[model samples]
Target: MLDLQWFFLLLVHQLIQFSSFSMGMRYLRRRTKILLMGRFLYLFLLVIMMSFSTSGQSKSAIANFQKAKEAFKQNDTDKGWVHLEKAIKKGGNTYYQPLIFAGDRRFKEGDILQAIEYYDRALQIQELSSIHLKKSIVYKYAGEFDLAIDSYQLYMKNARMSKERFRASELALENLKFTKRKYEEYMALGAPLEVVKLVFSDEKMEYFPSPTGDDRKLLFTARMVQDGAPTDENLFVAERSGAGWESRSKPVLGRVNTRLNEGASSISADGEYMVFTACNRPDGVGSCDLYYSYFDPVKGWGFPELLPGNINTKRWESQPTLGPDGTTLYFVRGSHSQADDLDIMVAYKDDEGIWSRVEKLPSEVNSSGRERSPFIHFDGTTLYFVSERSPSIGGSDFFMARRLSDSTWSEPENLGFPLNSFGDEFSLVVNAAGTHGYLSSNRGKDIVPEQDAMAEMDLYEFALPEKMKPEQRLFKDFVVVHSATRIPLGLANVKLKGLDEKEVYTGTSSKNTGLVRAMHDGSTALRVSAYKKGYLPYSAIVSKVELADNSTLYELPLTPLKSADSFVLRNLLFDTDKSELLAASEQELRLLKKLLLDNPSLNATIIGHTDNQGGRSYNQKLSEDRATAVLQWLIDSGIESGRLKAQGEGMDKPVATNDTEEGRALNRRTEVRLR
Candidate 1:
């Protein structure tokens, strides 16, 4: 009866919007944007307890709805949402205003049952297909998974929205069904994982846990806040499994933690570099940006520095996870709006140790819904992250994907129940050994319905299921050092080529420790190499047979180039017993060319040798032709012919015995002799 036409217009104006990500009470995620862990959740819980959210019909109903309009006008969504729920209860639903507003407000506020009821009430008034989409989400939250699946299917079938309009939600529905099937398939094998919550001896709120590659330290966000005080978030480190760990006394990260919030960090393999997210700082480029720090034995972590300008933009960027090599970064960037807008991005460190431009991951991995919390395992292939693109399980469920040999990703496998149940689950990290995993959970709230939401979150550890273990493989520690002095060559380049002779990994030795750790499937043939300027490069072959018993520590010696020195070019590849080179040899060939070009006065010989697999005369002619090809290449590249010569030793001078493929691989060689 009262003029309520304005309210209907307001409702019609907002037909499409939703959110994702389980709210994490821990630091960096605590107050992050819509796609990340929820900081608003802490405030939302308090509001839910204090506000009116039941249905009723009173004379003050009209006045209550008016207050909601004013709150929305002020852009105070949380305030407006609280008042709107009250307005709905006070007979405001009879006024022809969209009741879907109250449903979404309750859903995001973690009130699952009431949200469903609100949606049911909305459907009673008008049957919009979009209302089914909203019901599916609330049903999933309430663990009415069958109902959720049905609602999603109905919305997709009944909604008359055009293909251009319905494409996102349509694709999301497909992925949801597929991923949920995979989750169920894995869970059918009987529950093998036992998630054990760790009661921190210090007992502050600790989450975003990442253990060092050596398992010596645990890095996470830790905070302590009283009921009525301002919240402060800081990074904390706890010594693991020793006096520092047993005492359970955690220390604030010196120099790295500031008065403002800092959390969501990733540490390099050698513990020398840490990249994290910081927001609203004086020097920030956006509302939030990625920052980094270097760890020095004498100084702890250095004061944080802004990453490359291009990596941080005017939009939200956070949750950086460093790959095992520490050169590739998998992180998230998004607007502070819908979960559908959040996307995972990546960047690689170049030969000069600079981060290249950021690129979003392909659509095969990311969905229109929120994607965050990326964790790349030590194997360099298995990637774990959180996504709500599939709402069949938890709205934001943890998933594992593999980086294929082609550099694209395999379909995501939802880490099954026990790991991903109802409600919000995120921040799951596996140990370097792939034997165990760790995550954060509020146990009191999980087991007891009335448990206080203010309770600090505790970390949990579980034995990883065998099926969920990272690829069974081996890791090799490569220490790059000078041949003449044995001094560590920090920041040297390291590379590994697969059996197909394509590069499997290209990264640097640690900037401080000069250590480059590599991992691979035990069966693959590989070429290992390391390079530094002012030195002869190091290269070797790890045949599949040799790889079976490969040693853990490979001390690669980088010989300083000088007069009358001969070094085998072990990285060069040839087609079987043929003489012509394979494309795989280009990397070493380019390095050789660069070295010769750098030293104009140094004359060099292109020497070639072959294994004893062919006739002596035939081998001799083949070697000569191969060496001549290299010499011609050098001359054509503007090198002085007078400074170079080609020669053939054939099988006369072999580096190793000419038996077995491993020895034969070593016997066939190209060498550079400084004459």
Candidate 2:
């Protein structure tokens, strides 16, 4: 230190002595210029001498710095740190280089306190604007949030007005605030989260669970290794036991698991079918495409076939999630060239039992960043998925939205805090009862002790927070049958319309089983209908209380299309105490129009009946007017006016006792009689 100081003092001394030579020759201009050149030469000599003295003092620092570099190259981080500290102590404090390097190394190693100390020491030596960002990050890691925020403010303030560093400084501060808000909000609402590790699935790293509507089983993705070869992703199943899953010896599910990759499956709510992803198959239209398989009564699961329609392209499609009723499917859709631009897509099954063309969800849910692992809850309204968009918890995080209508969805809400962290959390699903949620994460070691310490990805179930829960759901099953013969009918198109919101769900009864299942919220009243070829359409308005019994099976009994056959139109709606048809009757009216179009030679009489609430004469006229409305609609829909006749029963014949509201609702009906 003294030698360096002596070097600087010597330079000042030579400068002063050379100025005297220049002053004495000032009277003669040429002599003065010569003396000035001599004075410059003397100053250069002094600078060269100082350089030698400083270099001699810095030799030990340079040697230690080289040692630190070699240690770091060899990956001996601890040894590198030791050498770095020694170098700084040996007069290496001439610049902020070594100090900042040490700070970054410690920060990357997760040594928060040491990183903070090094950054603080470096900032004192030279107040570099970039050092403030390093300091801010270390403070954030230490949970000193207030200090971290202050550091970010200083960093941004010291940054240049127009430069690359300023943008990073600005974004860093914004992200810090967003992360703090998300974390604090989670803490404020957070409770005791009990995450259950499904060790039953721990054998080969099972993930992306898709629970059946009854929560009776969990279908997940795993690996299938060939003879001494690399593994291919495949589907597996785990049956639900008393309170947990049954640890099976080998639960490889179905013929879907082939030598090629097939994974990320979704089971229908009725457990009658599944949709999964397969890649590079002979028939595939993309790198990965969604495949469909049906449940067989004799065999466990039938062979998988490529999903019908334009659902696949040159892009990749994976991670399918079927809606509870099995009518709609949601999945991940990504481009072959841009992986980060993945979006969540959907498709609906039509009356013909083929999936419609795939449509990506709107930008409201699919942000500019990647969207993945969509899981539609059994409630049939809420959708949970993963997004790497803004306000994320570093990596990907779980976000949820609800179906506002068939075409629109609500704003996405982050599942928040302990449920999401610094790493990726994906493929989140809620149980049938909405009591628990399941997901896949590599955070098993930190979240639970019993889980394997090095578990890369493990299945876990956590009780869903109250705000995070979807609506309580129940399974609604039914069969379409003949009214007189009581014989089951297949290929019936059944639709359930929620009375509260007019939200409709559609499904086709199985061709062989004659079984139909739809998800119900257990609260909203429903207008359920069934239609089939060569049969009269059947519809009934079911009250909310009737929808409570999950085990109850309802029936849609259709009368065969023949001369003189009549069936009740229970879903027909009219204005109170009037005959004008309400807008609510449009759906039922469309079905009647289709019926007339299908049978051109058929002639029918539209008869309106009333409950036992009004006078006979008044009821007769009102009923007659209501019946005429249907006839007029048929005529307007291109049915010949002479082919339809209107009549009124006027409460003369009661179908039920009418003592209770249910029986009265049954008695009030508009019926179509084939003539």
lDDT (CA) for every model shown?
0.72, 0.77
lDDT of 2 by residue, 461-541 (tens): 888888888987676778888889878787677778876645446766765566777777666789888888798888888
Cα TM-score per model: 0.67, 0.73
Clashes of each: 1, 0
lDDT for model 1, please: 0.72
Cα error of candidate 1 at position 46, Å: 37
Cα lDDT of candidate 2 equals: 0.77
Pick the lDDT winner: 2
- Candidate 1 on 174-197: residue-level lDDT in tens? 755654665567567775567866
Worst 10 residues of 2 by lDDT: 446-455
